[model samples]
Target: MTEIALRAEGLYKVFGRQPQEAVERLRAGASRDEVRPATAAVIDASFEVRSGEIFVVMGLSGSGKSTLIRMLNGLLDATAGEVELCGERLTGASAAQVRGLRRRRVSMVFQHFALLPHRTVLDNVAYALEVRGVAKDERLEAARRTVDLVGLSGWEDKLPGELSGGMRQRVGLARALTADTDVLLMDEAFSALDPLIRREMQEQLVELQSALGKTIVFITHDLNEAMFLGDRIAVMRDGRIVQIGTPEDILTDPANDYVAQFVQDVDRARVLTASSVMEPARATVSASSGPRAALKVMRDLQTSAVYVVGRDRVLTGVVRDQDAIRLLRAGTTGLASITHDDFASVSVDTPLSELFVPAVESPLPLAVTDDRNRLLGVVPRVTLLAALGNVSSHTGELPTVEPPPTVPITVMSEALDAADAESGRAVPSGAQEGAV
Candidate 1:
């Protein structure tokens, strides 16, 4: 059975006296705008997060992203409704219970890094453990390991003032890691860093998430960041959740015009994964097959290349039609010796945008592999262009998750221009040692 990390049901938070009247009115078919001047910080916002998933909560300023995250950790009390943390009700828990849960179960990463200015990086990170009454020696050891984990191995002795904004943020993250909490609540954790550093932090966070598998509730205003990191995103507006879906789902099928406009300028390549552009491979050849037989198979399929697989369909290498024919005529026996690893491979989860350069650079199609390195599909260069081309222009149709067969040749030029423009802005994958 799937373990749910957290769940919020009919959650509502309102500030000011006589809150129940406003809550009742809002619940009885009243709009948030109508209940204005009442300070409805959150209204009937409910969602569930699966264990080990990065759940992102995003909205415009005043959309209640921060409020929602605060409520999740019990840092802010909900006026009404229940919050279940790891199947236990956190809503009605006493202040002491909430404090205990926070100290042991939840760790938060704030936007403006709250590193202790007086302490060194190592000491700042260890402070969280120290608060829990952990021994000084043990906390420092744990803090040192976390500092290394966050790529801050050499600067453990430096104070917060001695480090740049990015380095300080890493220290903050290292502090959270030291706690070893099951749930992480991050509120605009990287919003302050410069573009390059922010991107690096984003990548590192994804790396750590992959390694640690901590259930995370990340709050952000950046849609691109949310799309890149979120396993599922909940978009809020007017103190209410408007939509909840995977990035793919939100991108391809926005809930309304508000969302559609929000993502209009987004660079899709970065957000769309390899699975989005990947198509069925043309053909496959057994490692035992002779070069002549492989050439014949390519001819039958009317293709230029085929992926070669060893026993159990484990991918070996790619065999081009020309290579197959040349090897056969040169007296080569089978595919084992003739196949080449010229093509780069990515996992099904790799974003389509990262492949833009590799697609243009490599002659062979990109192979998509599974956990065991079994061939799942191939993302041909043309398929990638087709996917990008279909969205580059405001072509009449709504964008669908499915990739198109072929796009106009102009796709290459337009895609490049868009890619460049998207890089400077904060518009916001995968595996098998894939080359980008």
Candidate 2:
């Protein structure tokens, strides 16, 4: 019983003089040529946008992304199928009903600024309120507040032509804000700006969306831009949806050759985060810690890396079972005698992109630490690989269990010995559980 803000089923749209006849032909399994128009704008599209979610549609030009958003807001009627907004059917809503729905429940921002050319920014924003019959003074007051919210506090009096393209888009956004709708549909709203301005606009949109918590459907052709802003992205091609998933899923585990090629060039480190890969810190010994201690700890644990803490319990280094055995052979006794101090460690707030460089550069698992330098957890490469695989499958389900604490060396050694015995195999002297 998850609440959905918007849902569409078997959504179909065709642009032509005989729209109904075209739909009838489609229902009868007629080819495109048998239909009235040569173009098939949308075909069998269906998806749901949850409340407070940013759902993005991305495709090349003429791929029906634009047409789809228009249908969502009742700007274009579906030639077939149905669209429901906030549990209300839209495909059959009357013209006046649709107008009221757009006015009170949905707002749209287009690639073009769409501001009135001759009106001041304030007036342009107030126009939406005016259409809803708010008092002149009240509409202006609301418009002023919205203008400030969009970071155009002092430019309320300036005309659209007087402002820069980015500023104009801000006015467009402010106008949408003034509508105060529960759903915001953006159709390439930032695509008209320069690259730098586009990035800034995208950031602003993210900030606004965070504060508003509205259900948003954003359309774009730039995959990176879509990834940056969308909670989920639906990729479209040839008037059909190819795949839908989070940016991490599309990048780490593509659905097929098409999606893989779509995200092949993305920096994997930049898009993946530590939370998805990090597990609870396991027990560790310093290089000075005894081999027997390390062995005991590894035997109790089923992990690959252990944090080596100093006397203060501050992270000093890390030790893997292989390294522990190597150190044991070299006559090392304590963890301090075997720990590797040079490795990548991440703070909790570190972005997924930033973790990649360190992860790739370090031979050991990535250690996670708090501000006080206490070990929080470790992220194994295998965990990251598995997370990527799950995301690629488009399931979008996160694992629920947290990794267990690190085991002491003695306990780990005993566990390993027991495991070998249970399996009827000889225990290797140096093969111990490593920390992760």
**Whose TM-score is greatest here?**
1
Candidate lDDT scores, in order, read 0.81, 0.78
The TM-score obtained by model 2 is 0.73
Deviation of model 2 at 192, angstroms: 0.8
How far residue 68's Cα lies from its native spot in candidate 2, in Å, is 0.6
TM-score of each prediction:
0.78, 0.73
CA shift at 95, candidate 2, in angstroms? 0.7
lDDT of 2 by residue, 342-400 (tens): 76788875766576567666554678887888777776655665554445323445554
Q: Which stretches of candidate 2 lie over 4 Å from their true place?
A: 17-37, 275-295, 298-350, 356-364, 367-377, 381-436
* Candidate 1 displacement at residue 417 in angstroms: 50
* Tens digits of per-residue lDDT for model 1, 63-156: 9888888999898889898898887788989999998888888899999999889999999999989999999999999999999999999999
Cα deviation of 210 in candidate 1 (Å)? 2.5
